[model samples]
Target: MIHPRGIKSLFLLMLLFPGFASAQKDWQDFMKQFPDHLDISLLIQDETGEPLFQQHAGKRIPSASIIKIPILISLMEKVDEEHMHLDSLYTLQASDKVGGAGELQHLPEGSRITFRYLAEEMIRISDNTATNILIRTIEMDYIQHWLREYGYEDTQLNRIMMDFKAIEEGRQNYTSPQEINDILIKLWNGAWLNENSRAEIMHWLKGCADNSTIPSQLPAGTVVAHKTGTLDYVRGDAGIILGDKPLILSVFVEKFDSMEEAESAIGQIALKAFRDFGR
Candidate 1:
């Protein structure tokens, strides 16, 4: 005979997953309304681990700067281990500069910035230069270690952003919709941090100003802590929706005619999930 708790849990899973197809008809219907021009993948889950809804979740695609989420988590681990400090200052050099999404590239060489500034700018503005600073400080392999430990087998950060040489060498960053959502779940579950540091991570995510995707179509007052990634033909966002029945949403769009179309699709998907999940 099944244990009482196990039976109850099994019942909950049945209730959520078995009926998900029928219950998420609107989401399916919404997708039908869009043109057949994009590879759209979505995954949403309630506070529990139930698969609220998923489509093409296991498919891997370019992550753009969204890979920074894992990078951030790895950095936090180092912070907790006392190997890094929020107040520690990192000096900027000419080599650290990159050309996408940040004020750091324009800042003069010989500038000094702290971990707090770099991390915040990295998330808030999707700052590529700040990401390089973090990548150089902690190393790309260090972040990959965290991804493996966290069970994200298909997610990879093989090269830094806008790296043409790396691209020429066949290096790229990739992640699945399911894996991205899983990372958010780990963060939500407080996988490896104490209260203060976890809260700080959330704070930085909440500070993100590029709300072009998941948070775009949510209710005006809705609070979402998410990271967005954009490339010429790809757009992605992943994070949590907080306050009253929190939900996690990750949407990835690739091979689109225009960035605007992809961003609109993600916003619509996020709105559907927010409504379907009863948030």
Candidate 2:
């Protein structure tokens, strides 16, 4: 039996020691269970954008489709600047189609697609053809400028998806878990876009088709506005967890034996974060 004053002291002691110790153990042990070749970058920031837990968060890795997040941001910024309108239509020719994740290639040639519709498919389904269409429609310099201005110095899109020539040239898109989370935090805080644009972007993100990663282990009906980028065995999922406490998480898994395993690992990480942060 302990006195009430002693109970209060015990609680403080737990907070000062066991809390940090447990979190550290959880992260380290989880990572150690997997081989080191599996390059994984994870970051969890509280609603205030303060770091709660980070592992290899700064390491630059393959951006995969996650690079589209910044691309989408720049597109939205262009819209806000009145340089482009979401409703503006662009004709997609046979030459514009790329082989990869999206369904756009199956569409009829000369299919007119609105910028907003392209952006929607770009995010919601990780559509490669739609992404390439936007990349072709939006200037490369414009996207790079926006990323630099946004402080995503390490994140850039160097080529359209499935650009084998660019691949031969060793030019590829790249981004990190840290950068994506920063952008997500900004989007969550409404830092960059106007109300209407932000609202629409969030709607598209929530409609994202991939749920095997961060959102998989979360409770059903949990609203996570996230996008998933996968390149072979590497996977990235960055999003805002819109639950009781509102958290931000970015998990990048690379060089895994299989995407299935990588996604399972990420789902576990997200579950731990949910347990820690969700009220």
Candidate 3:
């Protein structure tokens, strides 16, 4: 007859070798399959808003256009308070054009555009000209005050669209991945803006023009509301991961030698984080 101790030993071995071993193997395989030089910062939390994994979470990096999140929020707050109407008209002047990934720069001077369209272009397309007009209309100080009021201690809008002065003064722009994730979580939970405004903001986020990072790795039907910021050697993506479970994730990479390599590294890190914590 078989000894009970032998059976117990085999059971214990199975218990020790399965799930943990599989997890380690999966992580290792991911790391080996994709190798590139980049600074990766990620934060993922569970459906209950508990943190699941974090890497380089506290580091600050140039936000690029991702700083537009607070700008969007601040603008929505004004709409929520009825201080500004979405349909309110703003004239686009020659000085308002900043010349980036947008068509607004090509429009004639003194052309009129509604706030709703400007907000859409700003968030959905990262239109630098539209962002500049909104910033000039709303003012940076007010945006900063809104950030402080919303408990975003680490978030800041230090400049207007393509402002060379601010960039030269060592205050170009910056945000931590953690703070971006925090903002996303609050927005997802309907706490960042009013319920109607929150829904509207998320709707705009869904229309983000850039999708070369996290969205590129996700399945066809996966819903990710994200904003992407790109400079020569820096790429950042921040948004909500909506799946069987909803979580906020922000991955920022900086000082990459090549944009393509940096993007590939960010994609690999995003895929790993999504598979691990996205359920």
Clashes of each: 0, 0, 0
Which segments of model 1 are wrong by more than 4 Å? 1-21
lDDT by residue for model 3 (1-279), tens: 112332354356447768644654565566555445556666665544455455666677788999998888888888898888999888878877887788899999889889999989988889999888788777889998877886666678888777778787888677777677778877788775789899889988989978788787877788888888887656988888787777677777776777776677767776766777677
Model 1 — which ten-residue stretch has the worst lDDT?
Answer: 1-10
Most accurate candidate by TM-score: 1
The per-model lDDT (C-alpha) reads: 0.83, 0.83, 0.77
In the range 197-260, model 1's lDDT, one tens digit per residue, is: 8899999999899988888898898899889988786789988988478888888888788888
Please tell me which model should have the higher lDDT, number 2 or number 3: 2
Runs of candidate 3 with Cα error greater than 4 angstroms are: 1-36
Q: How far is candidate 3 from the true structure (C-alpha RMSD, Å)?
A: 8.5
lDDT of 2: 0.83
- Residue 34 displacement (Å), model 2: 2.9
**lDDT string, candidate 2, 88-117, tens digits:** 989889998888888999999989889999
> Is candidate 2 or 3 superior in TM-score?
2
Selected candidate, larger lDDT, 1 vs 3: 1
